[model samples]
Target: MDAAPSTSSRVQFRRRNVASRARWVEEAGAGEVVESKGKLWLTTGVTRGSKLCYNVEEIGFLVEKGALILLNDKDEMIGIEAIYEKIAVGKYGCSWDAFQAYKHLKSLGYIVG
Candidate 1:
């Protein structure tokens, strides 16, 4: 009988879409005006035979002068101005704010293509 392969020869599988937390800010009678302080799993832009891959990252938030701020691991401010400007004009209808935020982040080089 042949022995099984060593531990190093075994392939490891990881599951995507793990759970995380998100903070929602609501206005008086408005319902979920903003969301912040969450850990999101973002794609690394690598495709495996047609499927996309993602990894998790921690995010922080700050509301300053009516702007929704997103901070990095070093607590540095990542610009969300373009996103806000786009939203103000009602251009991002049908899509939720989360999606818009993702797009904005991607555009800013935070996420790879």
Candidate 2:
């Protein structure tokens, strides 16, 4: 793991949709992948094959912490508000309240499953 950056690093993550309710992200696009010096994936997300995939809640938490900046297929920056909107649309157990709890738990130094 690298040292934490002095400022927030703008990472590019492409949306990898497995289903209507499942929203995951991968460090995609051409060129070099932006390094998030902080512990971005150490506690969140899971590895699918060679890629690190983040769910809706995980992505929201990362974006809220300024550890990620998601990008579209066209390489456009997806705003934080847009990210929250996407997270809100998530079904099943993923929701803004759930994300809030996740963020709060992480802030308290507890590792979330």
Worst 10 residues of 1 by lDDT: 24-33
Worst 10 residues of 2 by lDDT: 16-25
lDDT of 2 by residue, 2-110 (tens): 9886974344343433111222343421112234344555776666666566666666666655566666656676677877776676552477888889877877778
Candidate 1, residue 108: CA error in Å? 26
lDDT of 1 at 112: 36
lDDT of each: 0.32, 0.58
Q: lDDT of candidate 2?
A: 0.58
Strongest candidate by TM-score: 2
- What's the C-alpha lDDT at position 47 in model 1? 35
Model 1 residue 45 CA deviation (Å) reads 14
Candidate 1: TM-score? 0.19
In candidate 1, the residue pairs with backbone N, CA or C atoms under 3 Å apart (3 or more residues apart, or in different chains) clash, namely: none
Candidate 1 lDDT by residue in tens digits, 12-112 = 22221222222221121111212322332243323334433221111211121122333333544444453344344543332345544644565455753
